[model samples]
Target: MTDTQEHTWGERYADSLMNTFGQPKLVLTRGAGAHVWDTDGKEYVDLLGGIAVNALGHAHPALVEAVTAQLGTLGHISNFFASEPQVRLAEKLLALLDAGPGKVFFTNSGAEANEAAFKLTRRTGRTHVVAAQGGFHGRTMGALALTSKEAYRAPFEPLPGDVTFVPYGDAEALAAAVTDRTAAILLEPMQGEAGVVTPPKGYLAAARTIADEHGALLWLDEIQTGLGRTGRWFAHHSAGVTPDIVTVAKGLAGGIPIGACIGVGESGTLLEPGNHGTTFGGNPVACAAALAVIGTIETDGLLEHVTALGQKLRDGLAADPRVTEVRGEGLLIGLDLAAEVSAAVTAGALAHGFIINNPTPHRIRLAPPLVLTQDDAEAFLTAWPAILDEAFEGQS
Candidate 1:
């Protein structure tokens, strides 16, 4: 395949697919490890890791084998019946969370998981939810109501009301907004969509205290930060606070479509038999993929690897004077550019065979796979200056 072939595929894609994502940047054909090849056969290191969903990278042998083996035996089954993988995966998630005696509601995506949690909060007889301003939960109507982005929420009006938005990382503001009537205080331990913004120290603990005082559920949305993306089973683990409800997806199944809305302690029983349901949420194949992802992360020591490599990448990326600030933990990294050139930088990086993301005008985010090699990180670092130079030239 050549550039001409890629262009042809792009045209075909435009004709066949909806333009929800604006335009196809590349027609990706195949992937292995942390690398992918486009229709034109151009190889690139996937530093964005499918927006933090590919925890084990692409086509990992363990993930493939698990899915294949599960599909061979039992694949899809209605929620009326349970399978071994589904039950086992739920237990495994509870064990990993270290939250005793919890219940899990499986979903197909993060938005669905958040929606499950949102409904669970409603069971407490309160409708008001206090969420952080810059935090992003999901795109569904229920999750969208909790998301504070005016642009995303504006177009979809009359969203489930009684949701209040407060400034993120501000414990004072969070404490003020949450009241006795608030059913839940929703937050992300570290904001992923707001360009990996981590809250101020003790903010989560403060939220817990406030929730306790107000009798509100403390719900942490770890869709992007959970399942070892942030060097821990859950990023909120670093804060040493136990949330009543936790929503996880993104990397939980290592590219397989699976999400879990876990409620701990009393909150676990909020959603009774009649409260919620899903047809394909806990399918055998997805559950098997999730178990395999967990097994691989433990066996390969990927958590420690992510922590070390992340620090190295951050130090190297921050060494460039063009980067004003760098934030995030483990493999989820975000850096601020000296200028609003993130769009040009991302385009330049793609041209240089490195994939990155621009979450905001001045922010560049990197959520590479846990399996990313030191060589790949070093290669990106080596190309950083030149990519910047090209992007700056484009701006000029």
Candidate 2:
């Protein structure tokens, strides 16, 4: 947009909207490929990729076509008459998991997906859910009960109950906490919000075995890590475990709001009719968008692309002494700084025409679009030390 249009947006945004996310960094006007332009015509290499939602990057033709065609033909039909795209998305997701005999319940966001799974666990004739500390489930009441962050939970108290917290990636603690009374053990294969922490080898297998021994369902939340973002359809697949329930969203629809809770084996049938219902959960447009995303991933071999690029990024970032550690697989990477300079780094990156996330004081996270190119990753690497220098320049 022109300068006048940009200023108008700044004024209007300040006048309206809540202060929940602080001041708008830039009024983004358009996006394409790995870049987005703000209203002021400044462009940024979107390393964070809208918190990992833009898997195919911005304005990919396949995604746009799928969404447009589906919207033109059939849009929101409610949940009474099932849409082809919705059914196809479920079938496609099941195929990706390679888990048999599963049923899916769709929602509009990751949290809602978790919300559906939370209630589904309750239907297993058990009310207890065991989750990991430093885990992020979601913000809604039911999902929030399973989330571990005190700050996010404290403000929304009196949440749905029967949740127990244990240390993440600790199988022994999970085994001890999950009794027969527990309906499910929910986990993120790689902790996204807690700086991309992956569990030790065999941790998920152990969790699966423990759940089996206790007759509790094993649930994997792949909201931030699914849809080929981590070089696999689900990050837990690397653990070689078949979880009874899996909740996915985020990149599922390549930015279209969509989420799903799928239960495998007999666990799929817990939620009976009238148990839960949503007016706009399985809308056609969202499902079509997801189908396009999946198709593009397969056709473009984006999974392999992510694996290669992620390693390049990790290797480059870890070469700096100030970067204490880099943890993650594929494009979902997180790094620890030598000092509590993550916030400064994030601000510095933005100023340098790049985008990243500071999930914790001493840690930075990057869930860039799986389609992030080698050139982009290399450019970031070239700028890495300088970014850190800028971040550290004025520190106390």
Candidate 3:
């Protein structure tokens, strides 16, 4: 591998692909477990886990085998027909939720899942939705409308309207914002894009009660926090609240591209026939891949592993004086630096053969694979101080 190998590929990517995500970080070639190799033959420990998508890490045998077997048998079928894997995956998700009698609408990504949930809210004859400030649902029109970022929403103005944004973790503000006309109250159990910000204790419960009082549906967007990412089947489970709707993706299929919008009890029936539809939503391969991920997590006891590893990582990260705060559960961790140097820290980590993310100027977020090894974690911790020193070298 040479500079030409990576540089030439970067040029080709710029020429052939849309510039939505800016320049490619690295021309990655292959991955195994929590490590990936670049086109330049450099190996990096993937601490970001494909932005929380690769729950089982790279090239997991279970996911690959499930997808290959399913595709070999029945790769795809139209929504007009059903598949066993699709039905079984839905049933498994509902059983894990334990919220009693729910129906699932599968999609190709989290944005589509949120889009389906948004439409479901409209079926209640109400247009207004109360969403939390600093909350991120997705980039699609409906989900973007619910999102509170002006930069993201300004460019896509005229997004579906009637969505109200209230301060997160503020139960009073949330209660005041909702009305009988409010169709739904959408929230993230833990705000991931907002630097893995967690709401106050009982905030979700408060929102649930508020939704009940207003006769509005409680919709929890677990796209980044669900499916054992937070060491629980769902992040809201910790709050002990049963939401009317839940949207999940990212790691649902361990990077197989699948999302689900689950509606509990009577809310499941709201999306009447033809209210919503998807072409590749319940493709057999994707469903089978998701089933395999769920199975692997259970069999491997990854939930406990994530919980313990998260605490270890958090404690080690917070040991540094430059780290102001650390927040998150399981593998979805976020830390704030003393200065606005998260970008420097990210680059520094990469230079040290590790991959991390800077969601904000001062915030570093880590959603590593559930299968991240203790040795890999210890390696990062041992290198943490040097990475920070390099990042803060020139800072005054």
Candidate 4:
């Protein structure tokens, strides 16, 4: 069954799908907890966790049940009338962020979340925004403007303007870039796409001070680091600075696709009615899914679990001489190999019943679900050397 289906599915995917994402690496059939079964019934530990979107692993009972129940009850209200889940989810995001007096603007993804936040910043009557180098907010026009990658920006020229890029984790650079005309200073508490680059200590606090000094809003993109993914409700919490605007998505709905743009204090009321809108932003099902994701996080005590498991993973991965360094917190782990075999390592892991990501030439990223087990961590640790051996031999 496996052999017969594998070849056919692979061929069909190549023939039918767009060439944008290269090839369909695997046609996954089903998932449960931290594992997924491919079209050919080969199972792999999904350490990537849908690129940190699957907060509750795959097909968690609570997520399925909540989404199912909400869809049946009140699925879409067209944004003309709000539902319980929408309001509750917004309030929940504010509470988790622990910022006082905020409002949430829902979106379908991280890109849209930034779009909404970008629009809100315009309401400050200032057009300028300062963001960090090595930052990735999203790919939409507005968010892409804030993103610093030259290749991504060069192709999509004439993006929405009045944007400046400065070095990340340098408060002095940020201060130099910002001014009274700046509407907001955008940052990621941890730059995930830059291979899990954690900012220097006191950076967020410094941003907060700088924003205040220049009468600009401090905006933090927590899309990749929120919802206990970093062993905290929001990664900025560890920095102990309050950001006026926060964008979140990724793991909020356990793969259901939802994002929120939160504006704190006076920033919450910056966008008046008719300032911006969305079609499916705060749909009930998505909010219910987010509720279920957050509920499960609290019920499972997964925060402590992630913190403990992360230390274990970092220690284990760093023990390998081939692994030069390990970075990130909680389940958002990244490591740099001594050689440029990240692509080979990614392929080797898939062949060895594990799924991980190679975000760069020399970097491997592991963002397993909060539900990833001690045994899975230990298994990966035990197989680290063998995986490296295979990667080197295969790529050599």
C-alpha lDDT score of every prediction, in listed order: 0.94, 0.91, 0.95, 0.92
Q: Taking the tens digit of each residue's C-alpha lDDT, what string does model 2 give over 1-396? A: 678887788788878988778787788879998899987789899998889899999999999999999989999999989989999999999999998889999999999999999889888889999999999988888889999899999998888878899999888899999997999999999999999998899999999999999999999999999889899988988888899999999999999999999989887899999999999898999999999999999999999999989998999999999999999999999999999999999999998889999999999999888778888888889999999998887686
| Candidate 1 lDDT over residue span 14-85, tens digit each | 899999897878878899999999876789999999999999999999999999999999999889999999
lDDT of prediction 4: 0.92
Candidate 3 lDDT: 0.95
Please estimate how well model 2 matches the true structure, expressed as its whole-model Cα lDDT.
0.91
lDDT of 1: 0.94
Q: Where is model 4 more than 4 Å wrong at Cα? A: 2-4, 394-396
Displacement of the residue 274 alpha carbon in candidate 1, Å = 1.5
Best by lDDT: 3
| Candidate number of the best TM-score | 3
Model 3 clashing residue pairs (backbone): none
In model 3, what lDDT does residue 292 have? 98
* 1-396: candidate 4 lDDT, tens digit per residue: 667678888788889988868877888989999999987778999999999999899999999999999988988988889899999999888888887898889999999999999999999999999999999998899899999999899999899969999999998999999999999999999989888988889999999999999899999999999889989999999988999999999999999989999999999898888999999999899999999999999998999999999999999999989899999999999899988999999998999999999988999999999999999889988888999998887766
Q: Where does candidate 4 have its weakest 10-residue lDDT segment?
A: 1-10
